[model samples]
Target chain A: MSRQRSMEKILASEFVSIGELVRLSGCRYSTLKFYTEEGMLPFKQEQENLTRRFPREETLVKIKEIQDLKKQGHSIPEIKERLAKKM
Target chain B: MKELSFAQNFSVIALNAQDSLHLTTAKKVFLRCMAAATILELYLDNGFKTEGDFLILNQEDLNSPEISRYHKAVLKTLFSKKETLSEQLPQYLKKVTKLSKKMLKEVEHAFAVALTEANALEEIPALLGCDLEYVTAGISMKEYRSNSELFSRLTESLRAETLETGPMTDEAILMLWLLRESGCIHDFFSREELKRVAERIFELQGSSSLAKQVFPITIHKTIEMGIKNFLKSKKDVMSTASGSGINFVFPVIERSQSVFIDTEKVFANKEERLRDIKARLESKGHIFTVIREGEVPLIKIDNVLYEAVPSAKLYRIPVHGVRLRKYPLSL
Candidate 1:
């Protein structure tokens, strides 16, 4: 199936692409990528291109949490440690 | 016929604009959408500060819940069926907020562009109306026999639709534009009065009324009719928890143009009042030659010939050498 068809096939419940992630999160791709690499933001690495896609409601909730921590002036490492320790 | 005369006690909109700049619901919503779109465009263009390897939002951004929610809402509105590298081009933003990609139906990207591109606030609703032609193009895609026919039909429809919307009489929108144009942030209880004054300035600046020695009656009458029309138009009812209206001025344009609004041409008597103004101005080294035009006398001040409008602002001038008037513009 074509990309458009596949996108149409997936319910609204499915995770969207990294570019869409950038849009929804209002964050840069490289930032999200770095965060993903450092196990900061939650995501699934599926598909042939190993492209990142996030669950709809989960991404929003997680992003809000990350935003709250960031507002408190927590660095990426500290955020990682805090989120990691919580997990 | 247009006429020019030395204006005394001309109406003031600058300083007065602070007390009355209020945006109606529809105007406020459209402006909010435009601001959000501009911010989104800036973000997509990587215009923010570079945080080492990653891009951060604005350095000064508080990233508070309110702003975050706003960003989230804008982001959620932006969706694409297929991923393309050039989809979010910063400069090529004309069609960036296309209808198909919009998750929310009401968040019009075209409206955003039209608003951002409009030099005057009056043109926003009109341009948005023009943009509606493009929006309806999808609907009439099969109706038109040719592309030219399609465009002509669309223009015709949009023109009619915009007229039906009656944006010309929407004072809230017009007042917002006047507020921005006059460099005022706050609006007042006397906002209608301010708009009337600003409109006169535009008319006076225009070539249509250039060098014309007209009565304050002519200017005031035209503006009065316009204000009445705006007042009669339907008010935009927006459902937001925002304040009633702007209560502060950004730069606070000073009340420079002193007014003495003469309803009965009482100042037109011009025996003592005019002499007082003349004597005071002459003493202050401001020389002016008075000329009689029609029934009323005209005076030249700073080379601009104007007839005075009586108001409370020009109260310092001694009326009968004793300041006999108990109230402004009453005697």
Candidate 2:
């Protein structure tokens, strides 16, 4: 019934690939890769195929937070600092 | 049985007459409706199709219920299916739409003329929000009596052209012709005034060129003439003073006697010689200045000084007559 719960259900039902995530998030594929490389986002690599995958719901939330911080004029270092504080 | 046959024949004749009349009227109405529809189609294609598309209906469509109703249905259907209407409709529909408009208007006018007493014709113009005056103003009343007459002339002129040439093209041509004939094109400016302005510009350009060529020479000539005139005036003044008994005396002691010489005659002769020299200087426009001491005078000519004694003797002297150097002269 809640908006967040409904979004989580949709994400769990859909197997959104990296390309789909880029399209949905409106972020560049290289930017997403950089985020994963920088440990800004948590992702997984398939054992046999070596393809990168992300938990759709968690990645979407993290992307939304990052976008919000950018809109608030936060520098990447500031964002990392805030993320570290959260951790 | 014979009377029954006659009645049947009469009925047949009546039916034929009615059918012919209906067909004629229906054809006219159908044409007008088609014209109105075509206009609406044009408006839509041109992107001006709006809620007031019905305003394009001709006089006949407004007058005849059958025609007006048919036009209304067509418009409704057209607009409903506008999203799917083929772009080619405008091309194909132009001729039929024009023909229909002409037929409908002709029938409506005829009907109005026939049923004058019923005032049926007046209602049609009123419904279309047009009067004879309004329609006349829309057309060139000087050239044509009615809208149909104007349109016919247009059609005749453009008969060879394709339907892609719109009605506006003809109207634009008519306007251009009228404007040309009325001499309205000359309202911009008079050609004679423009010519005069051009001439003035050329004259100014020539004057500037002449000024540029001759200005420095004129200034140099002016300075030279001024200096020559000043020198001539000074020489003339000196000559006049020498001739008017304004005596310039220079004292002389004879070196042979070591005493004053009886030089009155020599002084007079020296005065005459000085007068002659001053006259020559004046004629040649030579400039000089005179320096005077007690009973002696020195004349400066071109920055060189000359001393004249009472006798017929003269000598070149220094500028201030200090006698730094001297040259004796022949009498």
Measured by TM-score, the strongest candidate is: 1
How would you encode candidate 1's per-residue C-alpha lDDT over B1-331 as one tens digit per residue? 1110001000012111111122332233233333334343344334444544343443234244434333333433333332222332222222322323233223332332222233111111111111112223521111001122222222232222112211121222222333332222222214554555455435433422211211121111234334433432311111111110111111011111221222223344456456554554454344467654332345564433433322222345432121111111111
DockQ of each: 0.01, 0.01
CAPRI-style class, candidate 1: incorrect
lDDT of candidate 1 at residue A66, scale 0 to 100: 79
Off by over 4 Å in 1: A1-11, B1-331
Interface RMSD values for all candidates: 23.4, 35.1
Model 2, span A1-87: residue lDDT tens: 001112244456534445446534656555666776678887666563334566877888888898899899999889878877877
lDDT of 2 at B187: 26
TM-score, model 2 to reference: 0.19
